[model samples]
Target: MDLNRVVIVGASLAGLRAAETLRNEGFDGEVVVVGAEPHRPYDRPPLSKKLLAGEWEPDRIHLRQPDTFDDLDVEWRFGVAGAGLDPSAGILHLTNGTDITYDGCIIATGAACRRLPEQSRYSHVHEVRTLDDAMRLRAEIADGGRHVVVIGAGFIGLEVAATARQLGNDVTVLEGAPAPLIRGLGEEMGAAIGAMHEARGVTLRCGVQVDRLHDDGVLLAGEDGAEGELIEADIVVVGIGVVPATAWLGDSGLQLRDGVVCDETLNALDVDGSVVPGVYAAGDVLRWPNPLFAEEMRVEHWTNAAEQGAAAAKNLLAAAGRGAGAPEAYAPVPFFWSDQFDIRIQFLGRASADDAVEVVLGSTQPNEDGTVKFLALYRTGDRVHGALGVNAPRWVMKMRGQLMEQASWHDALAHAATLA
Candidate 1:
């Protein structure tokens, strides 16, 4: 089979890695990468942790060196947004009124941060999804003595709060849930995190609803639905979460529910045929079936993007063979970590399913360094769907490997205990 031109949308972690992998796989074709953002792909995790604390510089957040792409002969089209796709015509329409033809394509467009309500003044409001967002928020915190109000208790929100606290700024976290990370870590772990934050000087207000936002403060409604109370803040940072960036593919005929639907081989369902297939999707913009998870889920994590991007690239090369021998599959254990108040909180597996969980490791302490927290969530059978660790990278890493190996919950717990 002859090599074909590949166009990748969204120069994200997944897109970049995919392009590099194609070149490494000896695909000598015209590779073009288009990015909506002005800056190249950077490490987003550092944006909330180190960037907020002024530790890592924004310019240095790039995933690759400046000359890496040039060496790989990859053409980059920065600041250009992919408007839509015409699979029948084998063309990609751009926002700038230009159409580019591609033998294959990969859509790695990731998610963006959700904006606050319209009534709230966005001038003083901040977000940390991008480098610019992090820089703006970091400057405000570096200026000294600014009351930072985090409007969520997710990983990003908590990390920003922890960074703000470290920068000598008063931090207050407003979580709409009953406890911090309740939806993700269950009630027990969420309560443990809340207690840890409170012990570390963070004003965590859980189970409260924000009624409205004012110039001076936020009007919050208590759990009892009484009169709202005003909580004054200087700079408000919102980290509620994000949605997939697939607005442009509305009329593209691609099966998009939460993201671009794909098969196990990561092939875009729309352009199933065609020698020069014009469309494929990956990263946060992809909602593909996972043989490991036993369900179709959309993931916005960094590793997911990178792994899926590479998979899509390889599949594009093997399109003629009908995606045969594609080694890259979306079977990740689904892991994510956050650094807050000197405590490194790491999660392995999905924490959304577990109801009654048991703590088999480290005590619930915020400052617990190098400690592991093995949470066993058992409903019927002995199944450990999730595991949380504080400053315990090795434990989480081990659990992730076990999950990948399809280890049983009973065996995993017994093995984890031996390590403990």
Candidate 2:
């Protein structure tokens, strides 16, 4: 338990939070953060909205102020990535040909945006991921009259489409799935949300095959899966989701399925399913079992990254301190929100085996504030497992607590009755 220096990789939201928690927990030992990007820790959500829309400058999205960041008093090794790891030996290999020995290590490398096959051949293609990617895309879409075709109807793609349309550009969103955001909101609700965008003038093309990218537009697979019609576009943005940033951990001796598999306490697990002490993972690069939901979950939302990063750090320190109680277990309801155009979409909980989403409040129609003022409860058997709210923050917050408590279906209906 002789913990001294703690090394944090990936300088992302999760990594920054972990470092902050280590310092806050009175760990005065050396704290070193190695990041792939040259910039300091910065907020990412606004990259697709404010920054991509050209409404805000690059400096506006920094996660911390200059002086506040300096106050953390940690050695920052930016523009260098973690190349390898040796948890048993407590060594982290960096891409810059340097090895750092630490008493504790936390991996928060996050995820990278996934691109379509052969997408790089086209110079006009873009992605909404890092700050630099957003800046490059902003220049192409800022003029507003360009035809912007977004591949993938996920949050990032939809958000970019909304921003482009609001800036007076023609936007088209193509989703290979039956409905937009089907992975996140299910087909029914996702269709409803997609319709809202369609009503507001963004072209929504669902259940189609993207043959390949042409220099001028996207070519669709025509009849019999051959070359189809051409959707002309001046620019193309690929938001087809992301893959965990686990390339550096390929030979790190940790388990990597879809992401870094972890136990209930967020400690990284080895290939044989044993917790590798003093090593943890957070953000999109982590997958852990959630005792509350009785399901294995991997969340890619901001809230999860922030909470899990701190939780991992606390548990690591607790393990090191050999504290009074066992290392604290991380279990909580997942939550996420997305702002598109004038709508505020918030969701709590997750998709369970049962697809019973009951509309508990309001209508799908836009309210006076230009929001779809509605609340939907995800229930099955006798328990309410999740809830989705559109511009209904109070209801979402209340249900978030209830979902954490594992409220009954009847209780969820009772709450909705109160809203009625």
Give the winner by TM-score. Answer: 2
How does each model score on lDDT?
A: 0.77, 0.89
* Candidate 1 worst ten-residue window by lDDT: 371-380
lDDT of 1 by residue, 28-128 (tens): 87899999989887888898888778888977688988887679898899889989987666688999999888778888988877766773455778888
Winner by lDDT: 2
TM-score between model 1 and native: 0.91
Candidate 2 stretches with Cα past 4 Å from truth are: 322-324, 367-371
Alpha-carbon shift of residue 103 in model 2 (angstroms): 1.3
CA lDDT of 132 in candidate 2? 95
Which run of 10 residues does model 2 get worst, by summed lDDT? 321-330
